[model samples]
Target: MVLYLQIIWLYLPIGLANIFASLSRHIFPNWDYPLDLGKNYRGQRVLGSHKTWRGLIVGILAAFLFFLAQKYFFNHYQSVRDFSLIDYNSVNILTGFLMGFGAIFGDALKSFFKRQKNIPPGQPWFPFDQLDFVVGGALLSWPLVPVSGVVILVAIVLGLLFHLLFKLIGYLCRVDKTMI
Candidate 1:
């Protein structure tokens, strides 16, 4: 029970980061990105251009805070019920930053691939784009959290479903102009 609770708590930063990043779109209205597929790298900004520095900073900060919380909580108990997973320092601030950065990097990488493929920004590309950030974030945080294969499978299935549902909600809310 404690382990599960701890795991859920670890995701708080990630959730908060997403919320902060979403706010960035409205906060930085001047950030206009042209969805040009034909355009080559040309040493120019692509993929991650839509990702604001402010968002990154906020997201990282949120992750760091969450990590601190987790660390404090763990240090208080020093044991996770019957599990010893808490024996490691996986819940540190550094781990939180890694997870946050990993997730954002994955999203940015997906955007880059989408542009290269001319899939259009915000268009839903099955598997790759949808799971990119989750996979990246998970990979980054995996070293810290010793989640089992079953946990990973659960995460993947639930994450994908949640992604679709959120996209649908965003569309219905008219926040997402694209139906993808």
Candidate 2:
């Protein structure tokens, strides 16, 4: 539908950055480094052991490459270019690169808070689990892309739905240990 295309075109680059961070755990499990450096503040891990340097690297790299590819095609194809909300051809490449870092770091931040609250890993945290990366990605990339508020809101709604769907699929397929 027209709405679907518009929402996706507007949010795809940023969404990809966040999505790739979740995938990075599977792509390079060995590269995970605890962002907290295994130190606990008041008895809880800062960001936990799951937030790793490798995951950050993979997340940023994947998003940067995806953004570059989109930029290339948008520059070449009229159709692709027309659908883009953010100017791929002229926007800052750092926005795209930062998406990856932003998404992962966002989740890491959430993990820190979750730890503080004594929430266990892989546990369902309702919409928080779904929206963290989207919020993080959008906030970090906003300076460069500068999209409208409506776009971000719609993207958040879509992010929530997609997160639920993907988590369900992952659980059913045995790829994820928990279903949100």
Candidate 3:
């Protein structure tokens, strides 16, 4: 149970990255610079207008801030340190940046596939939508903080559950039009 908690704590930034990216749409409505710059592959949009520079920036920034807070907690709170998977003291901001970048990149990559499949943006893609960031964050951070396969699997499960919970909350709060 403690190990599971530790994994959840460690991967929280990845979850936050997606949340921040979604929130960025509302926060910076005017700054809609698509990552793909309106390019097309074959016929479809490369990544759609939803994947924007602002979302990436805010997502990364959110993860970075959360990491800094984690570091502070590691230094000041025994409970936080107890749940930590890595020694927060030894890690730096780059860890958080990589996590955020990896997550956003993963989502963007998924978006590319979604475009290829003719699945419109904001449409649910089932498990892929929930697990892309988790896999991306884990793969990108593998060299920096290697963990067992079990840990990775647990992270995926937790991420999926959390994504669904957040989506339901968004729907109930009227922030989103649908729940996935």
Candidate 4:
């Protein structure tokens, strides 16, 4: 149980980034401008209309703040400090930024390939949508924290499960325009 939680805790920054990216788009419509700047690659949108600069920036900031909250909690509560998967006492700017920004970039990479395959934006792309952020977060955060294969596999599996569960909830509640 401890190991499972440690793995989940380690990956929460990326997961929150994914969720907050969607929330940022919904909350701040004015800021939702494309990172691609109406550009094209091979006569098609490079990353599609949905990949926005605001989402990336907001996602990164949200994850960093979440990390800061965790740091504060661990610092104040010495007993539960063992639950920390990474060094929460020290500033973890690089790890937070990598996990958060990497998640959006990961989604953009999938969108890139999805466009090449002629799949429209906001349409479901199965496991890729779920696993992309996890892969991106883990890969980019490797320099900051070299995790074991077991932890990586666990994080991927948990991410997939949570993604499916959240999408189901969103669909049932009629949350339209979501990238689930």
Q: Residue by residue across 75-109, what tens digits does model 2's lDDT show?
A: 99998877777677678888777776777777888
lDDT of 3: 0.87
**If scored against the real structure, what TM-score would every candidate get?**
0.72, 0.91, 0.93, 0.91
Model 2 gets an lDDT of 0.78
Candidate 1, residues 1-180, lDDT tens digits: the string is 664444445454555555566576677666544333335574444663456666666666766776676666666764542344444354445777876777676777787777667766556788775576666666777777777755655555555666677777988999876554
Q: CA lDDT, every prediction?
A: 0.63, 0.78, 0.87, 0.82
Top model by lDDT, which number?
3
Q: With candidate 3 superimposed using the best TM-score fit, by how many Å does residue 46's alpha carbon deviate from the native?
A: 0.6
Could you tell which candidate, 2 or 3, scores higher by lDDT? 3
Task: Give candidate 2's total backbone clashes.
Answer: 1
Candidate 3 Cα deviation (angstroms), residue 140? 0.8
Q: What is candidate 4's lDDT per residue for 106-139, written digit by digit as tens?
A: 8889989888888889888888988998888877
lDDT-sorted candidate list, best first: 3, 4, 2, 1
Which pairs clash (backbone N, Cα, C closer than 3 Å) in model 3? none
Q: After superposition, how far is residue 91 of candidate 4 from its true place, in Å?
A: 6.8
Backbone clashes for every candidate come to 0, 1, 0, 0
Q: Which ten residues in a row have the lowest lDDT in candidate 2?
A: 9-18
- In model 2, which regions exceed 4 Å deviation? none
